[model samples]
Target: MMATGGRRRSSESDELELGSSGESEEEMEDSSEDDQENEAEIQRLEEQLSISAYDYNCHVDLIKLLRQEGELEKLRSARQKMSELFPLTEELWLDWLKDEIRMAEKASDRENVYELFEKAIKDYICPEIWLEYAQYSIGGIGQQGGIEKARGIFDRALTAVGLHMTKGVAIWEAFREFENAILGTLQPSAGSILTPEQQEMVNAQLDRIHKLFKRQLGVPLLDMETTYAEYEEWADEPDEFVTQVYKKAQQQMEKRKPYEENLLAADPPKLAEYQAYIDFEVKDGDPARIQIIFERALSENCLVPDLWARLTLYLDRQLKIKDLVVSAHERAVRNCPWIVGLWKRYLLALERHQAEHKIIIETFEKALNAGFIQATDYVELWQAFLDYLRRRVNFSQDSSQELEELRSAFSRGVDYLKQDIEQRFGESGDPSCTILQNWARIEARLCKNIQKARELWDRIMTKGNATYANMWLEYYNLERAHGDPQHCRKALHRAVQCTTDYPEHVCDMLLAFERLEGSLEDWDLAVEKTETRLNRVNQQRTKAAEKEALLTKQEEEKNVQRKKGRSEKKAAKRAQKQALPGDKRKADQEEWGAQIDQPNKKPRAGELEEAEEEDMSAECGLFGRENNTRILETPALQKQKAAAAARNKVLHDNSKDDLTVFVSNLSYSIANPEERLKEVFESFGHITDIRPVYSNRGLFRGYCYVEFQEEKAAADALRLDRQELEGRPMFVSPCVDKAKNPEFKVLLLESVMIILFF
Candidate 1:
């Protein structure tokens, strides 16, 4: 039965091995295809990069593909070349280091891995990289002095990033675990008596473990409570020092717990919360904490250019650590290559740090290759580069390489803006001709080459600037300062004729120039030209004024006629409304008979007024002359009678009758006063006319006359008196011509009182 079982087990093992081998073969085939595809993609990206060398995304893609293909030689070369051009990001460095480590088969092969580790650490102080470095060094611990080397690496790692509040715990724990493993190896056999040598080794190992725990417990790290508990369980005796360190670490942990909790609860790219936490860390002024917080923020907000910009600016301005500041700026530009501001700032930072001239030039070239968003951006960038070039030149030298380079850059800039920028944007980016002006100024002021300056000014003028008086004056000044008087006069002459925008100013400049230096003939000619131009300008102004006056007169006459017609219609409607009920019935009967006798005949104005008055007298019980006079003599009634008399005088003088209401207290800046008044008065009844008073200059005078179709409509509109319009209380009152009736003084005084009350 035993033999049978052995045979069966062997058969099953063979079957399992066969199945595993088949699966491995399939995976190899799949990986081979994937490698081929990745190689093809790498080739495509290389082709794209050849066409556009500054294609940052393509560079990243090509590097990723090469690393994935396990083409070790090519990958190394790619990474080296990219690092030279742009700083390698943390993830890329890790990938490169990991690939190198995996390929190391022998102990000797670890040399390259160590070198790569050094390069990776310098790029960014990533705690993970340090931990990986320390762990990888442990594999060679059996070699000569290997243990010491690994310990040294661990010590360096701790010193570099041991203060990291979050990830630092891992490194500390790894250090302790290595020591514990060493202790386990040093222990004597279990349940066996130990020699003096064995006991001494055991005691030494135990002391090392205790020391490691003591050191780790002094620093506050996340999950350090677990480390403290383990140390307590492992200790042979109760140690007061260990307890004190644990208490201190626990206090530190509690203080940092809120920030840690916030970071833990946040999702990826928690930029705002991270910034606040970083600010708190900065306020604490602990360099370790501040750096860790920044790294934490950057790990999540790596794509955020402004965060990178802020970090770099801080390093540049405050820290002033050349390596740190330069590395940060390089990374910022690499991540956000399209941002011209970042590239510009990078250039300035390099200059500020006194970086080599060649590096600065290469960086500027890269910036130009990094496409900007607008043509104006190109112009501004070119100007910045040109300014840098100009600063390198020594003006005292008659002709130097720097001066030549400066001149060449100026020429290239103008041509680039004209050809490249204009073609792309459909207009010249240098609309103000600033570059050419700068070139002209440099030629005249520094090089003392008036001829070259003249040529630059010629180009500037040809570019649609010749018509501007300011442009002409600029050229004239340049000539007067650098060239002979002949050129200055010529510039002024061209300006006088070509400057349409400010011809008078240009003419006056010409006359002044002539008076200063011109011959008598020149002065007389300038005067003649000035007189002719001024006369022509005056004639044009007079013609415009006359045409405007004619239009105004026509408009006023039309408005008067329209007002008269509207008043007549409104007055007729009011008279009909004010009629007594009996009078209205009688008038309807008369209208019915008239329609049959004289079909389309209308009542005369005088007859309508007489009928309306008779109806008013009968309704008010003032049919007798004596009673009417008595009622009119009352103080309150006198004011009403005076207002009525003034309104009647106005209506009669205008040959129409209507209850025209006056609206005051309107805003002086009110727009469309007629339409506004119509909007308000039309709600009561049909608005017959609106006449907003205006100054002679056509500005609103804060008042208007609004005529309504019926007396009831006018009375209803009075309810709107003292109502607000445009933040001012509007006064609506009957339009009474106070000038025609002396007794209207009382009503005018009452109107004044009402205005004052509001």
Candidate 2:
């Protein structure tokens, strides 16, 4: 059918050509066969294409087709193959590169991929690509690099990113390089030594590293001045700054050095360094840390005086009293006599340490021998001795022997400080007031005799200048302690008379007089003084209230007068308006209304003067106790003061030595007790026989028989019994021996006594 159609078409074309040209049959048939073969081959090729496609190759073709269709996912997958195979292909490579860049960014593997892109950028000179490469290099460090190498990498990175030169990104990259340099790029090799040139390289690298670090920190490196180098030359001097460097270098050695090596190294001002740490730690409120520091300090030579004082303070606060701590402080003071704090702390530590007083006295003696106890400390030591003696005085036992010894020591100590003592007493300077007054109080307390205290104070009052008024007041306390009411009163009165400059002291003395003697009259006098002050205040207040009342009353009268005048004016206006015509009356009414609505002006000068006078009068009437609550408050305070004085007097008079009895069990018996009683009686140096009184049948009675050598002996034994027996209270009256009667046997005596019940 194709040959026939082609022949017919050929005939038709030949006929059309006969109208224009000519054609042949064989050529038309040949053309027809060729067309049939082409159609069949096209069909076979289409079938082969469907049957022969490989998955990867088909994917590549599909990708190309999808790329032309703008399918990015397919294009990306195909680009991945090309990247794995022909990675340097500029078309496939750029596509692969861009896609890889995108993938690297999406996975946050940009830092890992940055090197590859950086190479690409250097080769291509693509500013946009280079910027992307630099952006991804933030916080990235070369793994196999030193500080110099790191600095070069940072400079290159900065130059690349500097094309954009945003401050925020530059800051981040600089910090990253700085941190990398400090932390180091690689682990250090053990026992590794470098050549001199390598060392020089290292030093140059370190300098660059330090400069970069400083730049990142915003601190100028040139300005640092190598504080250590400057002070190292002056290290032998004991100045604060040299000592500070010594301290810091020691710390660095400790922090960076291994423990074993640290132990083996030569001593490097370790004591001074630990002391610095101790001072710092103490200021930071770390007592235990300070303790560790102090321990280290003392371990490396003995601790310095200042360090010893702080260490003892730490121990004292912790309540750890050790012989070692005591020895440390004492040694500190001995080594440095000028360390006053150490001296004080040594004494204080002794006070806290529960050793005997004799031992403490020995400690002070040791301090004196060491030349650390100065004259001032000697005075303090005396006061401590006196206080110890006073506190030891008790009703339990007579501490008189100890007190006398203490007093002797105190006197010796004062004599030791005598030169300073005399100079101090003669100074009479205002600054010496507190010290002198304290000394006076100590003197009063230490005096065994009230008469001595009184005599000493009298001498102070007579020869010692008028500057010693406080000393006089302290002496008043001695009379109070004596429980002599009249003496207390006289002392207070004399103290008040001695000085008028001290009103508070006078008032205090007055108050004390009232309290000590139970003198309600003095209390009333004190109240009267307070009441006088209150009354003066009340009188002034009353005058003010009276003046205010008068002013208010005058203001009320003026208000009434104003209302009356307004009423008269309104009546006059009404009368005037009542006589006018309609329009004229309206006009008059408007005028009157305008006048009525007008605001009242301020009062005239005459009225103001009158108001002022009324105010003065009211305030005058308001003066005195009627206007002031302080008048009432003052009376209440007086009542309280009186009650307090009376109570204090009662308490003061009632205060006395407490009753104390030290009880010890003498003897206890249950069976064969009469023999034990005889033994007891014999031990007491007396002639006495004891017989057990009991009922018949060998049962014992609760009473016993006692016979003494004589009547005086019997009475003496009874007296001793009353004093020694526990809960065996007895009535010591003489009685006849009933067993001595005619019919009474010794064995029946118990029955007789039991039957008689006596």
Candidate 3:
């Protein structure tokens, strides 16, 4: 008994010594501090979860904290809760399973580990987990029925992950290794012979190994060529069937080589190449390979939300795996937090997956805080959320919580757009007033609350929508459909008054409404109001038309006058050019003779006839006149000359009467001077002609004659004397011969005398 006591003491001393050697006091203190930190983290996570049960990050943190604290019960509960709420990621499952498996000590405990392994495999066909499961089952082969149980697990794992191109080889090799071990156990001892039953078992096990090698060789897995070569070396006699399978797989591998080569040669963010590869894998229809390719692409293109969206859509539609689809959606929104479409799609996906009500609300709140790039984006997002809420409400229930919540959201949305969106964007995003219209519609149709509908319409109008005839008509129709006839009449009356853009349409609508449901008195009042308003509108339109016509008539008159002046000026220039030079010379000689006060030389008849002949000869041609015979004037010729002289005297008398003005000092380079001068002087009075003097060479001579149709017009034009024309002062004087006007000379002398006296 003393010896037994000493042994117990020695064992206790060794335990203390082991504890002391394993951890110093500083290490122990650090460990205690770590435990305190973990506990504090747990408390913080729990507090956050209480505040927001939908906080996914907080749930994750709490799970990690409990697992680190080795609180198995709490950790299991946390994981279970999280699994129910969210799909666990591959890494999270691995961590949880590892912790669970390490804590198992009994057969029942091992059974729990098996259940976890099953759960993990269902979440994703992960080859590593299947291999671990197979190997774990192999360790229990010594118990009753353990060998067959282990064999069954290996077979199940092979079927589950057999098509994984990159990681599948591990499971295939593990299965074969288990079968080979069984084959060794069935073999007789070194020098002994095996019984018939044992011999048959060994042959069956060997056949299993051969079948596994042949199956693996046929698959187009990564490093499959190495597996084929290894099988050739391991098999006692290589099977022709195995060789044929390897060749077929090689052909497939060749077909896939280019895609793999492209992936390797691409630079970072190889989205195009990955998309091509993904399409190929999808067509191949191996979910495991498709998933692997997606993961490979996302590692390089994590920020590409479209890639995430595509993967999520595929998982949702094809796989229909709730956890995977939800996880992809969550990651997609997290990667592109500011994309409103991503958040909107996430909300829809949540609803489709039947997420908790509080979780959907929290997600919507987070979406609102996502800071969209435009006011319209906010409206669309709000519409999506409202659509979800609308789907949740049962219209039959008049006063349910959902109905109240829907009404509250409508009110908040309107105020938010008016106060927040307008303030930031400088214009209301809800230009169509869709939210208010929807609210009014809901109140009218579903709630049977016409008063609330009326209030909403009033608010819509006060927001500057009253001018629209359609808006008023909408209100009228709503009242007609849901309210009493009196309210409909009131709505139409207000519409007629407030509708400015399309008053006639509103008036017609009021008349139609009255015709449908009105007394004789109402019909009379409607007709009177419609006629009075129409008459007022017609009068205003007529006044505007008269003013416009007056302006147009004035403009047309100005254009006509301008065109007439131009035509007259052109005619005068053509006439001036065609006038004979002899006429000009004769006028100059007459003026010179009058200035000298010489009596006209009246030659004898014979001398007059001879002088006329000489003038005609000079005009015809010098050489031709010498050979031509002269003819004596007849009685008709003498009469025609007397008539011309009489007409010339009449023209001279009209010139003296101030019917023409002589303008000089004009621009020599003036183009179309006759027309330009008409434009300037026609403003005074009616001008008959403007004759600009030109040189024999067809150039302007800086002087012109302006003849008026009336003497008063010439007098009025004299007021513009000495006015600047083309940067030179123009001189205007009566076309009267100065030598014939003795009174004008006497007046000039008197003006000189007055200036001298002053």
Write one digit per residue (lDDT tens) for candidate 3, span 1-758: 12421111236666578567875767757866987888788888888877777566678878877766666677788788777555466688889888877878999998999888877765455667788889989978988999899989988876767765667789888888888888777878889998898888888888888888988898777788788778878886799988998999888777777887887786546787889989998998878668777866775676687887888778878997776777677767766666778888888889998999899999988878766767887888888888898889998876789988998898899899889999988988888788889889889988899999999998999988988899988888898789999999988888777777788998998899888899999999888887777777779889999999999999999999977876886686466446687764464356445535633444455444434443444345334544243333333344445444434433234434568887877778887887899998998788877766655334567777888888788988887776788887777876655575555676456544543442
What is the lDDT, from 0 to 100, of the residue 444 in candidate 1? 98
lDDT of candidate 1 over 1-758, digit per residue (tens): 12321111226666568667675767757865986787688888878977877555677878777666555676777777777656577788888888788778976679989988987776567898999999998998998998889889999888878878888988988988888888888776879887899899889878887888898888888888888888878885749988898899789778878888888886545676788888887787876667677877876776688887777777776788877678778877876777877887788788888899999989888888777767887878887888888888899988999999999989988998899888988988788799999899999999999999999999998899988989999988899888998898888888877776788998999998998999999999888877777777778889999999999999999999978886896788687768897786576567446556765554465444443443345336523433232221222233345445434443222322246777887888887888888877898888877776655333567787787778778877887877799888898876556564454588678777766665
lDDT over C-alpha atoms for residue 723 of model 2: 35
The TM-score between candidate 2 and the true structure equals 0.30
Candidates' lDDT values, in order? 0.77, 0.47, 0.76
lDDT leaderboard ranking: 1, 3, 2
TM per candidate: 0.57, 0.30, 0.47
lDDT of 2 by residue, 596-627 (tens): 56534333543443333322322333322222
Instruction: Please report the TM-score between candidate 1 and the true structure.
Output: 0.57
- Scored by Cα lDDT, where does model 1 land? 0.77
RMSD of each: 22.2, 47.2, 33.8
Instruction: Give candidate 3 misplaced runs (Cα > 4 Å).
Output: 1-89, 121-125, 140-161, 188-207, 234-241, 258-273, 282-292, 295-305, 312-758
For TM-score, the strongest prediction is: 1
